[model samples]
Every structure is written in structure tokens, then in C-alpha cells.
Target: MKDMITHIYKGLECFLLECSAALVRRRALGGWRSDPRQLREQRRDEFRARKVAE
Candidate 1:
């Protein structure tokens, strides 16, 4: 009984992790992109410039 509960808990943890990662990916991508060209353009626009030390 205890082993079964532990297995179930581990499965739940995996499920939660998968869902969270999917959400994070969606947020990072700024939502879904149906068109390939537009998606590329959108991604390009999301880039940021950083300062470099000389």
C-alpha cells in the first residue's frame, strides 16, 4: 500500500512538471504561431541587445 502511494505521488509530480513546462514554453514563445514566416519574424523581433565589456 505504501509503495503504491509513493508510485502514484511520483506520477503526479511528473504530470505537474510536464504541464508547467508546456505553460512556460507557451509564455516564452509569446503564444502560438500558425504561419512559419510570421513566426520567424515574431521570434526575430523578440530578441534583445546586451552590452559587452571591452
Candidate 2:
């Protein structure tokens, strides 16, 4: 039971880290955007590229 809990916690931590990284990338790209649509597209492209690279 203890080991299962530890594994679950670790998975959650990794998920949170990924979310934070995506948010950071979104914010950074957002700073350069003047249009909401462009920002959304930019984030989507960035996320795709990162996933492909990974």
C-alpha cells in the first residue's frame, strides 16, 4: 500500500511539472502576441514541436 501511494504521488508530480512547463511556454509566447487567436495557435505549435522533439 505504501509503495502504491508513492508511485501515484510520483506520477502526479510529473504531471504537474509538465503542466507548469506548458504554462510557462504559453506565457512566454503570449508576451509577444497582440492577438488572442495567434497566441492560441502559437502555443499549440510550440506544444506540438516540444512533443515531437521529446
Candidate 3:
């Protein structure tokens, strides 16, 4: 019984850690998407690429 509980606890802990990591990654990416400077830089890169392709 003790081993079973320990196994379950370890599984839950791993699951929670994975979820936390995913949330952190999502927030980081979300910040980049919402950042004005990042958006502007992306747009500038796109424009430059288009100009070069022409």
C-alpha cells in the first residue's frame, strides 16, 4: 500500500511539473506575440524579405 501511494504521488508530481513547464512556455510565447517591439521587428523583417525577393 505504501509503494502504491508513493507511485501515485510521483506520477502526480511529474504531471504537475509538466503542466507548469507548458504554462511557462505558453506565457513566454504569448508575451512575444503581444510585444510591440517584437511585432515591429517581425514586420520589418518581412518587409525586407519581400523587397529582397522583388
Candidate 4:
């Protein structure tokens, strides 16, 4: 029926939109931890842990 076809079309359109949005979010956040400040902090933490273990 036409109603069923319309429902299916809407569902596919929503799914495609969600997929594209997720791809955009992935690209945007892919380098989230590459910030120099965060890297430095992580290194500092590791160094402190090593010092504590020794």
C-alpha cells in the first residue's frame, strides 16, 4: 500500500541521515586526544606512575 511505502521511505531517509551524522561526528572527534595539552598531561601521569613504581 501507499502508506506502507511511505513509511519505509521515511525510515530509510532517517537511517541515512543518522549514518551521515555519525560519520561527520567520527571525523570531527577522531583526533580528540591529539591535543598537545592532553598529550603532555598523559605523559606526565605516566612519568609519575613510573616514579612511584620504582
Candidate 5:
């Protein structure tokens, strides 16, 4: 019974670690594309202004 409990506890620990790692990876990826929409809008405005100047 003690062995079974230990196994379950270990499994839970592994699961928690995996979840934390995934959360960290997700946060890192989120930072990469954080302002994509805003950046796209800014780029479009700049492009339009450049065309007007030309």
C-alpha cells in the first residue's frame, strides 16, 4: 500500500512538473507574438504613408 501511494505521488509530481514546463513554454511563445496585431497595424500605416510620399 505504501508503494502504491509513493507511485501515485511520483506520478503527480511528474505531471505537475510537465504542466509547469508547458506553462513556461507557452509564456515564452506568447511573448514572441505579443503585439503582432498592433505591429501589423503600425506597419500598414507606415506603408501607406510611404506610398503617399512617393
Candidate 6:
């Protein structure tokens, strides 16, 4: 019983840590972009595409 409780506790701790990491990453990027540079390039491309489309 104690062992089972310890295992569950450890699992919860790991899940919490993963959740924290995801939150940090989301806050850091401000969205779902994987990298800051990638996000910038994506925006630039999008602007160019819009200009071309018009």
C-alpha cells in the first residue's frame, strides 16, 4: 500500500513538472511557435504573402 502510494505520488510530481515546463514554454513564445526565430520568419512570410496576394 505504501509503495503504491509512493508510486502514484511520484507520477503526479512528474506530471506537474511537465505541465510547468509546458506553461513556461507557452509563456516564453507567447504562442505555439517552436522557436523565436521561426516565429519571426513565419510572420515575415505571412506579411509578404499578404502583400503578394493583394
Best by lDDT, which number? 2
Rank order (by lDDT, best first): 2, 6, 3, 5, 4, 1
Which runs in model 6 stand beyond 4 Å of their true positions? Answer: 32-54
By TM-score, highest first, what's the ranking? 1, 4, 6, 5, 3, 2
Q: State the TM-score for model 2.
A: 0.53
Q: Write one digit per residue (lDDT tens) for candidate 4, span 1-54.
A: 999999899778766865565455446656544455755565567556755975
Winner on TM-score (1 vs 3): 1
Model 5 agreement with the true structure over 1-54: per-residue lDDT tens digits: 999999899778766865565456547657555566755565567556755975
Q: CA shift at 9, candidate 5, in angstroms?
A: 0.2
lDDT of 6 by residue, 1-54 (tens): 999999899778766865665667667777675786765575567556755975
Instruction: Report lDDT per candidate.
Output: 0.59, 0.72, 0.66, 0.64, 0.65, 0.69
Estimate TM-scores for all models. Answer: 0.56, 0.53, 0.54, 0.56, 0.54, 0.55
Error of 3 at 36 (Å): 23
Model 1: per-residue Cα lDDT over 1-54, one tens digit each = 999999899778766865665566566767764455765564444332111211
| Cα misplacement distance, residue 36 of candidate 1 (Å) | 12
Task: Give the runs in model 1 whose Cα sits over 4 Å from its true position.
Answer: 34-54
In model 1, pairs of residues that clash are: none
Each candidate's clash count: 0, 0, 0, 0, 0, 0
Stretches off by above 4 angstroms in model 3 are: 31-54
Better candidate number, 3 or 4, judged by TM-score: 4
Best prediction by TM-score: 1
Please list all clashing residue pairs in model 5, or write none if there are none: none
Candidate 4 TM-score, true structure as reference? 0.56
Candidate 2 error regions (>4 Å): 31-54
Question: Backbone clash tally for model 6?
Answer: 0
- Quote the lDDT for 44 in model 1: 46
